[model samples]
Each structure stands twice: as C-alpha cells, then as structure tokens.
Target: MALPFARVVFLCRWGAKRWGIATAEARRGITFKLEEKTAHNSLALFRDDTGVKYGLVGLEPTKLAVNAERFLEWAVVLADTAVTSGRHYWEVTVQRSQQFRIGVADVDVSRDSCIGADDRSWVFTYAQRKWHTMSANEKAPIEGIGQPEKVGPLLEYEAHRLSLVDVSRLALVHTLQTDFRGPVVPAFALWDGELLTHLGLEVPEGL
Candidate 1:
C-alpha cells in the first residue's frame, strides 16, 4: 500500500541563479557555487510502522526493514532525514532481497515505482550477477564494480554531486552531477522475493 507523500519537492538547476532549469550548470560549464539551506542532518525512517518492518538494533543502521505480508511483492522506504545542504556520506549493507536498489529520491516520487526507474532518483542495483544505475527510464551498465557488499554514498548537496563508492574496494563506482531540488531522503526498494534482516544503517563518516 502506497501512502500520500508528506511533502512535494520541486527540482531546479542552478548556475547564474537558483531554480533555473535546462542544465544550468552545463551552460555555465561545471562551475557551481554552494547554496545554503537548513535541513535535518540525521537519518532515520519516516516512522517505525512503515508498511514494512522497521526499527533500530544497537548502532547498526538506525533504520531496518524486512517487509510484511502485504508488501511481500515490492516496497519502498525513505529516511526521515532530508539533506538540503553540505557534503555527507553513508553506507547500507544490502541484506536479504536478491533484487534491491540503494540511493536518493524526491519526497514525492511514485510510491509504486522502484527507485532509479524514475527521473527523480539516482540509484544502483544488482541482480543475477549484473550491476546497473537507474536514471528515469534508462538503466545503464556500470562496470569495474559488481554487487558491493556495502555501498558508500557521498552526497554534496550544494555542489549537486552524488558518488556511489564500492566500499569493498575503496574505489569510486559511479558519479552523478546534477542540480536536483527538493527534500531528498535515502531511498530503498526490495524485489524478487521476501528479504530478510541484516542491512546496517549507521552513516559512515567517510572513507
């Protein structure tokens, strides 16, 4: 069951100004200045009673889910903390679900759709020994890194930079530089079958 979004985020690009669309940064050529905004700095689920199982166990992942009877087919969960400014990094241990997505999404992205399958999200996933990145309807192959045991995401909100690090090898796997606007939260999805618990939630400080 998908619930109504608590808020709606409008994405905008920046370069000579704020909220300018049309790949503003491209027109200005990769030189983007930092814009400041106040937003929550901690990460957690919107609520504990999500359609899927969620809670905290010690310091591992502050948030966790395994899915319930109703959402056994597919489900999505967003972190309570929304990043609006500054540079931040975090990691997730993809546990049970053989098919899963890890990345960020707008507050109002389609609840029924999987992350990365839509334009508002930037994510990475693995299934059947293959890895890919999702951007809207496009799924592109990402080589040199496959099925990372732990994924480290480095987000520079003001700079509009997103990098997915292969924590297993301490190497950079994928990177995206965009001016995505809105209250973005860490997004997760599980598919293929029921996923068991074991994913960690604690935000890793850095490499």
Candidate 2:
C-alpha cells in the first residue's frame, strides 16, 4: 500500500528563497510540463519565488484514509522543520510528532580542513530515519494549494522519489534559460554532487 504521505525534500546549497511567491499560473505551467515528461500524474508546483518550492500531492481525505497517523506525522514535521546553513555546510531537519526524523546534510567536502588539528572533515550526507509512537487525535488545516486537477491524490508513491530532482532541475534550467540573451544549450550542469551520491543516483554523464 502507498504511504499516506511522502515528501521529496530538495536540498539546495546556494539559494535560499521563498518558494510560495511563485504565482498559481506558473505552478500550472510546471505541472503541465511534468505531465508531459513523466507517466505518473502531475501535481502543481508552488514556488515562493525566492528559492524554495513546495509541491504537495494527495488530498487530505485520501491521506487520512490511507494512513491517518503517518499523514499527521508528516504534516507536523513539514511545518516545524528547521533549515540551517553556513559557509561550509547546510542542513535541514524535520522532526515528526512520532519522534521520527529526516535530515539532509550537505557539506563542502572539497574545502581543505587542515586549518587546525581539531578541524573536522565536512562531508555531505542524507539520511531518512523512522520512529514509532502511540497514536493521538489531532486536527490541522489542509488547504489545497498546489494540487493538480487531474491527479486524484496530491502525491504518487513512486513519483515522489523523482519529483524533487525534477523540480529542482526544472527550476535551475528555467532560470538559466531566462537569463541567457542568445541561443544557448546546456553545456554543463553543477549540483550538490554529494547529495546525489548519497541518494545512490548516478549523475548524468553529459548534458
């Protein structure tokens, strides 16, 4: 059975912008493009327009039916999670009500760490952790902000894995295309290589 709620968190190293500032029309465009590219149904993509994007799938009713406890757990975590970044590292930690946590840690491993004998090596890491807790009743608002019209649920089980990468890539490519003045094709792409490596996905060999 599909999990009631699944989220693909995009860990960006450089940009920190509000994802919700993206207009509804822009979200619709992204959704259409996503539908064109993949077999699974599309979900609307909302951007704060500053940097971050929140794309939610699956309806609250269906989510509750699928797994009320897990759905609530994710909702609480999504709302309360913290994002922190510095000169050499960036991290986001989501603490679920159930005590489970998911964290994405990205470090600039290429930087020299020999400044001091006590200096610690910085390496990128992504980890998904789970925990269990007794059930309790709780109520929260569920506004259908970035939900596609066609897809029954806000999210698809299998597609969640790819959506984060796809959305981030689309955002990056779209930005690049807009900035270029003349005909330009992708020459090379730079991303958080460590994140991809941690996910066990191979970076595309070429553009």
Candidate 1 per-residue lDDT, tens place, 1-207, comes to 233322323343322222222122232211111111211111122222221222212112213232110112125555444556555566555544467666776655554456787788887777767778777858877788765566777666777777888777766777876557765655666543322222222324343
For all candidates in order, the CA lDDT equals 0.50, 0.17
Angstrom error at residue 125, model 1: 1.8
Off by over 4 Å in 1: 1-74, 192-207
Q: Which prediction has the highest TM-score against the true structure?
A: 1
Per-candidate TM-score against the hidden true structure: 0.58, 0.15
Residue 177 displacement (Å), model 1: 3.0
Error of 2 at 153 (Å): 33
Residues 1-207 of candidate 2: C-alpha lDDT, one tens digit per residue: 122324423243322231111122231211111111111111111222111121244334432323211112121111111123110111121212111111111121111111011111111111122211111111122222121111110111122111111222221110000111111110000111110111112222221
- On a 0 to 100 scale, what is the lDDT of residue 204 in model 2? 27
RMSD of each: 11.5, 20.7
Question: What TM-score does prediction 2 earn?
Answer: 0.15
Per-candidate count of clashing residue pairs (backbone under 3 Å): 3, 13
Candidate 2 lDDT (Cα, 0 to 1): 0.17
